[model samples]
Target: MNLSMPIDAVTMLLMTQAIALVAALVLAAEWRLAKVRSLAWWSAGFATIVVGSGMSVLRTADSFLLYVWLANGLLVVAHLLFAKGAAAFAGRRLPGIWLGVLLVWVALLGTDPASDRTALFGLVNSALVAILSLKAASLLLSLRRTSEVRDAVRLGHIFLGHGIFYLAKSGLIFMPGLFVSLVGFKGLLIKASLYEGILVEVSLALLMLAAVRHRRERQITALAERDSLTGAYNRRAFEAKAAAGMALARRAGQPVALLLCDVDHFKAVNDGFGHATGDRLLSALAGILTDCVPADALVARLGGDEFAVLLFGLPPENLPALGRRICHRFAQSGAGVAGASLQVSTSIGAAASITGTEELPHLFDRADRALYDAKRKGRDRMSVESGVDLSVATPPLRLAKVARRA
Candidate 1:
């Protein structure tokens, strides 16, 4: 805890080694479960550092090879691995050519004169650690996302500060009146590094775990909210977003519109063409709806062969036109996804509510009734509940007999 006087340089090395080992183990365990590549890279970083620190602690009199060369080499590897993890987290990779050159340079460092090798290695290792840490921080800084921004930036700054500390250490060693002897200076520097390294290791562990947890949570959320077959919003996300959109529309004094879409003769398509073609038709239909709606609109797959589009800030009169657009586009596009012989069409039911007056559920009921009305009239057209238009055109009669009976 004493900043001016370290308890013991050897004790500090052992402590540093233990901290890195524990961090490595924790990251390795998480990597095993999550199977995240970045976690594995991070674990390798800590694991390498542990071995490097351990070599320094366990060095014998004849251990310049082990303590100076191999240990320092591993330390360089550790820094590079940490940088690699940062790049991986951001969906990137470090250049292999640059990494190869760095290792080659580390090999060349061993050619220093025997008397001056330790001093040379010390300075170079500090510089490499500083450079690698800063590189990792910069990589994290490049990611700007809503979900992971906080953790990414926090980790970036932490590594940034650690890098600056070592940069200062590497530069300050030769400054006058700081060290009485180079040997004493090296001892003190190791003690100082013990404190800094432990803190950095702990921070790295927590941030890594937190970032991974948050990322997985986002992935789970995406899976829950999306239709696997069509990539449209699932019913759950639709309802939630619809409510929010309705509220916004009311506040802005604009009407909210709902369009409920159904595939015409979808069962026949599935029966005749196999479910694969039918699925293609559905996906194509979803894409058509997505393309037809405004960017702000929400398109959802409500259930089997039933999809919904919710629009904000649109008048009731516009609903019929939007519905017709959806109906027409899918009619033209469906054959491309399946086959020219696979005839496909869509029936849309549309309703718009008085802004600041109608709730989403009430609007939903009106749209449902309109959808039933469309199914009764015939399939392959749109019906507007507010009566701007009862049908898009004379609908193709896929359900004419059933509609007449109804």
Candidate 2:
């Protein structure tokens, strides 16, 4: 828990600069692998800060001392890059007003004719850095709110703390003694800011790495959970979602429904129009199923020419209407795809657990039976099965059938 390392006062700034360089390198390497533009912006920002700090260190050399304001300007630019990185991460445009911030700094520099303009602009520089850091924090927090990227929340907090620190540092200029004690070295050429800077750099580097890792993990999970051809939930994901959805609905005392949908004469379509056309049609069917169902519903492709929909919190009475819409929309979509010469449509079998007591497997079995019933009655239609009556010890295996034309 002792985060501190052995430090030499004279070399503290150099240590901070070294840490920033390493963070920049590591982030740049991650950018190469992940190809996230935000990482590139963050890395460049870190590198720019290091360059500015390095330039300030050169102030001991009499010739370089006069341009310390230049170093300060670069520090401000580094904060700008940090803000831009956050904007890119959140998919937002750069806040153009911040350019006015840099212009303000430039104007302050020209107003002062001192040999060391850094001393003159010290308060201004701190204020600008604080403003930029706060902007970055706000943008990062928005990323968390909008994208559900949990790591962005942590990064936002870190930047928020950094911004507040700089704001306090700017105010400390009024009390030179206290300012020196806080950010200045103990009678050494380096600064106390160096100590804090090293810690900040380390934190930023680790958290940004975690952010990119989190993104890559989500991408991998999506690939595994989705069907590549139809972009719907795969069989594995569908099974998982069905079990969980039923459990949640049962506990909430809400009804759940299952709709088993199969393409009518799918084999014939494949034979007549070729497999490529059939694949396109299957993809189109997935879209139709998604459009017809509620946003919370799960649409999955169980296998070739067959798909399933899991609905929760829906009344049993509405299931038939949804099935009819899906069937009808798919038939229309199919006709447009390969022309009206080929008759194409879908058959759906729907079953509902009105009492929220039936298990997923039982519901699936009932739905499968209704689906076949639809095919038997006629293709391009929807068939509804009787709802489960949990109060009955022996519920009827099969009951009423309502067939709706597509």
How many residue pairs clash (N, CA or C atoms closer than 3 angstroms) in each of the candidate models, in the order given?
A: 0, 0
Query: Over 4 Å off in model 1, which ranges?
Result: 58-62, 101-105, 145-149, 171-173, 177-192, 248-254, 294-296, 314-321, 354-356, 373-379, 390-406
TM-score of 1: 0.84
Task: Name the weakest run of 10 consecutive residues (lDDT summed) in model 2.
Answer: 390-399
Across residues 103-123, which tens digit of lDDT does each residue of candidate 1 receive?
Answer: 754675558445645555666
Local distance difference test, per candidate?
0.77, 0.76
In candidate 2, stretches whose alpha carbon ends up further than 4 angstroms from where it belongs are 1-9, 61-67, 93-109, 175-195, 335-343, 387-406
lDDT score of model 2?
0.76
Candidate 1, residue 276: the lDDT equals 87
